[model samples]
Target: MATGANGQVGHELLRALTDISRDPDPHPYPSPGGRGVQCISPLPPGEGGAKRRVRGRPCEIIPAARNGTLENGTACERIDLADLDGLPRALDRIAPDLIVNAAAYTAVDRAEDETALALRINGDAVDVLGAWAKQHDARVVHYSTDYVFDGSATQPYREHDATHPVSAYGRSKLAGEIALRDSGARHLIFRTAWVYAARGHNFLRTMLRLGAERDELRVVDDQTGAPTPARLIAEVTALAIAQWTDDAAPLRDGVYHLVAAGQTSWCGFARAIFEHAQRAGLIERAPAVQAIRTSDYPTKAVRPAYSVLDTTKLRDAFGVALPDWQVGLDGVIAELANTRFMNREK
Candidate 1:
């Protein structure tokens, strides 16, 4: 059961898992073999198809969202995590082997005023998921943010570092992490940073929109983190799920950072997006992006100045190493351009 099916990560996760589940031996790459220069091993024949099943049956996608299934019609489980009254009964009925929860209140600034709702969805709901998974001896895959830290570290944050969230959104997410840890459930908490997708409303798309409308845009240059693609995150997660069932893969359920190999500032990211857009013919020329500090773009929620995550542990444990941020950006930029071009043609 995958929550937030219509969301950026959830949507890609659905696609990746479905692709892997259908394939005989799906590797960690975007396509059949792999993309770019990344050295991802081809999936073991013993690991993929059979292991994705529960009781010798194919796993069903239960898109647990308030608005129900997407237009594609795969997931029919219309569940709202906020109002989880029927969660236990529903879990009892489904008895899912693994629950990948990609849902959360991601309104970073609005979470300050809507603390209750954020806590209800991000913190309390996760606690419930964890508890239920524990009861069923099932595994839970939960997504977390790097905002759990106050962005005070000069170096990348370690998994064992102390958490001090500055924003309400961060607090709620941190609470979810603590709840999952205490729930005693077999869970994998992935802490990622600067996530974006071609289809979703994110920084990459936002910059493209601004570039189309204006001649110049000011981006925060001080903030730094890897712009991780939702596709890579989902694919790696699908690989993790497949590997978890195989004893030889060594799946130790714990918190790990899953991010791109390299880092960049928001300014650098915007410049790259425009450059890619120009190359893809989405834009004729790159926009003039002005570099500014965090103080220039103040919001209700305080963002981290620097929140680079260390993914060495994840690579060492799961043998999953993500490609550089630029590589993922190129894929998304091309897709975005093609979609726009098609829409214009129509």
Candidate 2:
């Protein structure tokens, strides 16, 4: 089950899994089938469903209540990762075969002031979950970030490359990876960069809103990385999981870099957003997007200058080739536009 099901990756994962589970033989593009696939609750008989039997005591630290049932009848319990004392009992009860840790302390700039909180949640709690998973014999899929590297490399980073995180958030996430490695449990760690979704508060949404509201926008141009879609990550995660179940070996229980196929700077991504919005008539006029350096726009924490990760391992190992960043960006924009249009109708 997914831990951060309400977050960007979690939300899309829920949708994609629901779609696949419903139609195992669905076309790559399912429109020709005339039957649209979507996530549905109270799954059809013989389909897997989550119940109280799957989740134990819940602990939510993200302010929102931690209880809900997915369309597939999977009863999701959002628990605060920091509450280590209560986790063992919860794990004992849930008895999950696979635990996908999509939850993370992702406030990059704020993490400078909240380093302890970041470590507690991102580092310490991962150890706790890893230990629990080992005892329960459950496999884990953990999410990581490109910031784990210092971003000094002119070339893309391989999975086995040395990591020297420059920020508190990055260090903490790196620590989590170390903990998972030491735990001796089967684990898959995916390190991604510049992640965004159509539904969430991401760079794409922010740019779309600001491009329409302002006459000019200044974005950092020096930093370069793939702008990955959360939906694509979710889909790839599922594919990896399927591979794991198929062979359990050769999947290599270690880190893999997952991102969109191509790389782009923040300025380039912003320009693409505005251009797509203008083409789709979501905005009448695209604003001028000015390029700036990281030094020009200072923040609480230092960011990586170039965080592009090499996806050759994932491609060679899993045969999972990610779509281009522009293609993923277009899909996100279409989803956003469709969502907005549907909301307006209601």
Candidate 3:
């Protein structure tokens, strides 16, 4: 079952898993004939009639969200993570062997005042998921954030580094991580940074909106991390899921850093977005983006000065190569151009 099915990552997960599940081979990627790029672009329905199975059974994906319907108009199982008392019962009714959790309370600055609500959804609810997974002998795939760190490191953070969250949102996510780790359930915790997609309310979209409305914009330049695409994250997750039943792949349960290959500050990311948007005709000209210090744009929550994550462990374990941040950004821009650029705000 996939939680947060209506969300950015969750929506992509549904597509990726659906694409892979239609393949006859259990190991869908790293194709023997060496044409694996097809896996990145989703195939039209009935294009590949072959059925992919997990452990000798047909693969079925049950997507759950707070709403009963997805943005794409597909029905899903309704599940609200904040409803703590009903979580276990919902899981029991679904009885999925594998759970992919993409849901969380992601409001960073708002979490400062709503600390308890953030903890309930991100921390306590995750504890419930972990405990249920353990008792039911189910495997879990959970998404985590880079905010668990205090941004004190000059270098990229490794999986084993000590975490000192500097904000309430960060603390809540860290609590989830610890709870999942101690729960003794088979799980893969992916720590990613600066996630965005073409369709969601994220930095890329925000930048485009601001650029269209005003000629000048100021963005923070000190904080640095890779801007990861939600599509790439979902595809990599699909690869990991494919390895779950493959003896040769040898899936290991642990925490891993998953993000694009390069680092950039928020200012740099905004500049790149405008550049791409202009080229894609989403904007007629690139706006003037002024670089500013984090102090210039203070929020209720404290953001880490730097939160780049090292992906050496994920590469060594999964045998997957992540594209550069710019490359991913280009793809998303191209997608937006083809689908929604003409309709977008001028």
Q: Could you say which candidate leads in lDDT?
A: 3
At residue 41, candidate 2 shows an lDDT of: 17
RMSD to the native, candidate 1? Answer: 4.0
* Runs in model 2 lying further than 4 Å from the true structure: 23-75
Q: Which of the predicted structures, 1 or 2, would earn the higher TM-score when compared with the native? A: 1
Ranking the candidates on lDDT from highest down gives: 3, 1, 2
Write the residue-wise lDDT of candidate 3 on 1-346 in tens digits: 9999988899889988776677635444444223332223222345432233344445888999987788878788988999999999999999988899999999999999999999999999999999999999888899999999999999999999999999999999999998998898888999998999988889999998888889899999999999999988988888777765453332578899989988999999999999888887767888899999999998999988888999878776666657689888987888788677456555
- TM-score to true structure, per model: 0.90, 0.86, 0.90
Question: Which residue pairs come into collision in candidate 3?
Answer: none
C-alpha-based local distance difference test score of model 1: 0.81
In the range 176-286, model 1's lDDT, one tens digit per residue, is: 998998998888899998999988789988998889889999999999899998887887787777666554332578899988878999999999999888888888877
- Model 1 compared with the native: what TM-score? 0.90
Worst 10 residues of 2 by lDDT: 52-61
TM-score of model number 2: 0.86
lDDT of 3 at 150: 96
Superposed on all Cα atoms, model 3 deviates from the true structure by an RMSD in Å of 5.7
lDDT of 1 at 128: 90
